[model samples]
Target: MSVIVGVATLTVVATGFSPHTAERETVHWSYQGSTGPEHWAGLSEDFAACGAGREQSPIDLPEDTAVGTSSDEAITIDYHPVTAKLVNNGHTVQANVSPGSRIIIDGTPYELQQFHFHLPSEHTEDGEHTAMEMHFVHADEAGDLAVVGVLMEKERGDSAFTDLWDRLPTEEGDEAQINEPFDLAEFLPNDRDQYQYDGSLTTPPCTEGLKWIVLDDPVSVTPSQVAAYREVFHRSNRPTQPLNDRVLTLVED
Candidate 1:
């Protein structure tokens, strides 16, 4: 599979929150204070959806309210071992993956572009937050976005993230290259059940029409691993948005 690295000039659209190197310099939104999520829309005319969009992301998944569905409706993830570039993009620590990884939703394939971590899981279950959240961002040929969210809980030890946590870039604009291939599937839980919904990007621009597939089971990561990430990005999470009239589907496998 072909992979695109950091070129001096390149345009990346629709892959949610994975801003190109050039665009990163122009956008200056953070997770707190004056230039935080609350002030994202007002910060720039391009980020209008941050405040105005109704179908925003990171919503609470109240099981009782969700529409039940069988395992047949679950999205098919075809992730494999691949080289990845870990980048500290000011907001969150993101892993820009090589091609070959993808997920099939209703027969349409969306290639996995990257995955990022958010401190204190964004989408909550029963209004409860987890230690962290990981978003696997993918995009179809038409530039439509779909995100797979995995909630992380505090456990004793988890080697799945050892390579990433050990090589985390401490400074903004810094990056670490993992030449050796690593399977992203290791990060997921054994169960494939998920909570499905229609939502938008959790960051600036906050574009809507994204298919959100949040796994129901939380993955295990050590407290120290979470701490290691927090040291780089003290906190990077958008509060849960209102669900509005949208229905949350519980896809059980």
Candidate 2:
């Protein structure tokens, strides 16, 4: 079962925020070419679970499932935009976040630890694809998982994006933080309609038991932003998997 929540927005834009010192930590990644998603778990010992997990994300949604109750959850999210730095992971270019944001879903609140982007979209509908998508990863006090996805399309006059994209970090392991607060509501579509389902993570350690919500409407970005993103991540979306008889609900007004 699932529930959808909605909110209003202020004239929010993404731009030069602030830059932070790169916290040195030992971590593994599944990037493109040599270390892509297909070989994430194999790349490092920390990601063994990613390869052997039952539920994974980016599965193709089949048009059939046993109907059940629609979700009625109300979510409250707290996100601050800092300087967002882009890195060309082997799989794609990603904008990594500082660890202080959070999201509340269905009366349950989760912290927004980090976020990333995907090109051509990892998730699809009826075999159709969106131009780009963003994933805000959150976790609750108990470590449960929920994701907030914002989809993007080609348009014009996105100055916030222009500022951010213009100064993206060209190489991996490089980061900059923006000190300004980025209201997540700005990225949301005016319409609150969404789709809810059960799924897993698209990356390695493909853990299951995730609450997946994808907004039906997509926000606009300038062609230059899209072009810049392509230059970094020509393609990083995971191939959609079989739905395995799962249910998907379209939240309607």
Candidate 3:
């Protein structure tokens, strides 16, 4: 599968679609039962990556890690205000941002594509779970994938996600326009420290060779936001896959 990423365009993660998949790719799978993540590889021959990939994702950040920094891995986000669109892909609620937002990693510019959520977090801290996690999927012109993850914990007051929750498409393959002004920069935590690893996509077709950087710092979301998300997807997060000798680096603050 030859992946083709854009310079800075809106790209949402459709159900059963991977960064490595074609633009018109339509895959059939689910989050549970007969055609679930556990049984994804058997669904089709093209899904071989789901079961046999050595560098799978959503691994627990191992305990007792050393802190370090690398100029080569530094992230510089140049996100701009863009119109948002919401899509209920049956698995989770995905938000697509308009063009203009982009992130430069070590001088390589990666376009800010789309973002989606996973309940109870995916990657954990020594087996600890958070309220939720958001994946900001980005890619370069070559279709190389790089995801920046920000964990969301349960808190009080309101959340930036309220606008999205209000317009979620309950049914599968439903999409709606978001009239609100969406700022991608607002999702960043004050602490830029992160845990970097080489892993595959958490969803089926689980394509490998993607660059993943999960921020150690998490943002806060109101309890109402958590409840609202649960109503839509109670358990969208994939189970933690084995680190399997893969090294996780702690990027110091």
Quick one: best lDDT, which candidate?
A: 1
Candidate 2 wrong stretches, greater than 4 Å: 1-54, 61-71, 74-101, 157-160
lDDT per prediction?
Answer: 0.82, 0.59, 0.75
lDDT of each residue in 113-166, candidate 2, tens digit only: 556677777777667777777786676777677887777777777544655665
lDDT of 3 by residue, 43-96 (tens): 668678888888998888864863466745667767887887888766777877
245 Cα displacement, candidate 2 (Å) = 2.5
Best first by lDDT, ranked: 1, 3, 2
TM-scores for all predictions: 0.91, 0.72, 0.87
Error of 2 at 72 (Å): 3.2
Ordered from best to worst TM-score, the candidate numbers read: 1, 3, 2
| Stretches > 4 Å off in candidate 3 | 1-20, 23-27, 70-72
Model 2, residue 78: displacement in angstroms?
Answer: 5.1
Task: State in Å the error of residue 129, model 3.
Answer: 1.2
**Model 1 error, position 230 (Å):** 1.1
Q: What tens digits encode model 1's per-residue C-alpha lDDT throughout 11-90?
A: 22322554333253355666777777788789778788989999998899999999999889999999999898888666
